[model samples]
Target: MSLIQTDENIIAQMDSYMQRVSELAPQIYKRRPVACVNTFGCQQNVSDSEKIKGMLKKMGYTFTDEPIDADFVLFNTCAVRGHAEERVFGNIGTTKQLKRERKETVVAVCGCMAQQEHICDRIRKSYPYVDLVFGTHVTHRLPEFLYKRLTGSGRIFEISNDNNEIIEGMPLSRDGKIKGWLPIMYGCDNFCTYCIVPYVRGRERSRASADIIAEAKQMIADGFKEIMLLGQNVNSYGKGLDEDINFSKLLRKINALPGDFRIRFMTSHPKDCTRELIDTVAECEKVERHLHLPFQSGSNRILKQMNRRYTREDYLELISYAKKRIPEVSFTSDVIVGFPGETYEDFLETLDLVKQVGFASLFTFIYSKRNGTPAAQMPDPISREEKGKWFSELLKVQEQISRAKNADLVGREFTVLCDSTAGEGRLSGKTLSFAEIEFEGNENLIGKFLKVRIDKFTNLLQGSVIE
Candidate 1:
């Protein structure tokens, strides 16, 4: 079979699987089967799980939060960090007893972690109770895999290589009603030495702009208050497409859509970020005034080692331009404190960059090595103890910066989308700049936009609705 299946062919195949599952489900399941899908990783994984749940729902499965009460359990895994993988394994191990108690219960593992050969081998040998194992490429074939598992096809595993196809029209059972995740592109072409996303997610391929715009319109009509455009690196979107479009052009199209919703995207590659993109954000009122550009490392030498393709100076230049264009722009970034072969001086460079940026918040990591990545094979003299200390130091510095940033917002009023309840009578939401604030309100205010006045900051910004 060809690697890239046509969308019509895949859709037809899925329809067949849906029919077969419907036929088999009545015979096998006494009542509606309850599925517990535990997603671990990025928003991409969460979006993938939504589609998985959509398929399971078509197969007559009701959802549950508890695995013990579930007739089907799926672990949508992550390969970003070793700690994440370990947590997935630990969670999977807990299901062994559930499988023992309910022998008919189906256990499946899928996603980036399952795409790895070693992870599959380990699951096959160590966790024999897992009935179905598929990879990132074959997520669209979940119904087929589940059908085979149900029809006495013992322990199915389908981890095919990347086909570089963009499959659309898959049903989705989203987790939220207020916010929606719309993936504009998939996979990464950059292949930073310390990362495993390109290896597992395959090559970069963007969804056609028309499809994306249609989805955005539907999201707006569905009353979605915010639409988060997802990608491995969103700035690299519109590559490999036939249209004369790029990320900025795409944003303009979406921003032109009639809606009260806000636009947001993430993990923008600093190497690919451009003046046009920054200008687009400044001009587009719908796009949030926040950029989550991951610099990874501040030292040019360390950046060269990691193959991040941009220096601290280049990153700062982009930041400078963004700030000039949008004065209220809030920035968040990902930083690695202790990369391989990084010295104390290199660490200081990272800290210096953090202070210079004054990010609203930061997501810091201590550099977890992945097996297939080039950084894993590099020489590392830094001890785990030393890395831990450096990690703490970075966190302390960032906390001070974060507190100061939040402090500046005090007594200021901003419009925020109330998305969730905080405590009993309190509610939590995010400002246009992406800073979260908690305010006192009833549950009726959950999905509505409200004006909130920041009163104080203690860990989080405490506020009151300006009624």
Candidate 2:
């Protein structure tokens, strides 16, 4: 697969279409056109929707939180789990009535779910009211697609295979002023049997280090206090790149930038996580003292079946090393409770690992089968009822650990970036360790960093802003 940069010609075509759409929008609407861009699944999809919104804003469209109030509605979808796809379909079904009530409403779907041929066929055969459908690779070309649909092009579906190109310089209509989502890379190389991300997102490709550094500098200058470097496997960054840099080196580069901002990343594969990365997290003052390493299963046999290249011992060793280097570091993780062949004995190992690590929290799920994946074809004798029981047990164990961990934090002080309002006369923010703490403060504290003392623990950490 050859790496292709989006050429100037395509960019010019998109610009022309953008201008046409902007000119045509006023003629079609009596008032300002409003769009509802609904996002599903991961942070990557959220980032994609922000870019779509940016393009829509340029084309003279404002936004709405309700689809019923929208002249145009776009579903930025996810295909990670069957439930997410079902939710998207249910929401789309509701929009059919809206389309009927307003004949001119432009309804569209895009992102990972739209990349699948089966999903596209279903939408075509059943959902005739939908105007356009595009895929993960052509997000930068949304203006062109929207223009065609507006000009009476019937039901545009553009789910082409992976184009192996990284398009740069798309405008972003970010959701917040304080936290910025910066995608350092795109796609996945690991084909874990339980995941459809690699199939939907395509092969791994890293953005140029210079481009990333430029974006980071711009975000800091824009007054973004937190920068989240996003990817399927962030540790796999710099692969297939010309630079000698890797994820750890990249972190150090961003940490060196002059700012009071904090850096965080996610969904790290244990196989690609290195000692250098852990040490860099320990050493960098600007980087958050939190690591979200996902150890999906604890059984070596089940892990091998899942095609997660690392073993339980390997994961434990990394945790041990991380603890030795950064004693106060907090960890969050993802765990699957019931695999196709997982036994109660295998699950005990998972419980053991969880107890050993003492994680801050866990994102736990029972394995969901995906079509066109290797795991789906495997023989299974276990029942969903049994899986449900196992899932409950895992949740119980994790909850206890989490409460104990939070209780230990009582009386400790932390510098938190207040990001949102929790309730009346309350503000919520995250500590450098990525802990959510709600405190008594005014709304003016929303974008500022302040010292807070933890006085209690309940569902979340409760604190008071230091005077």
TM-score of each: 0.98, 0.98
Task: Give per-residue lDDT, candidate 2, residue 14.
Answer: 80
Cα lDDT tens digits for candidate 1, 1-467 = 22223489888899899889877776776777789999999999999999999888887888999999898899999999999999999999999999889888899999999999999999999999999999998898999988888888999989997567878898888888999999888899998999999999998888889889999999999999999999999998888777789999999999999879899998799999999999999999989999999998889999999999899999999999999998589999999878999998999999999999999989999989999999999999999999999999999999999999999999999999999998889999999899999999899998898999999999899999995
Q: Lowest-scoring 10 consecutive residues by lDDT in candidate 2?
A: 1-10
> Residue 319, candidate 2: how far off, in angstroms?
0.3
The lDDT, on a scale of 0 to 1, for candidate 1 is 0.91
lDDT of each: 0.91, 0.91
Task: Give me the overall lDDT of model 2.
Answer: 0.91
Report the lDDT of model 2 for residue 330: 92
Model 2 Cα lDDT, one tens digit per residue, 203-293: 9999988989999999999999999999999999998887788999999999999988999997699999899999999999988989999
On the 0 to 100 scale, the lDDT of residue 7 in model 1 is: 80
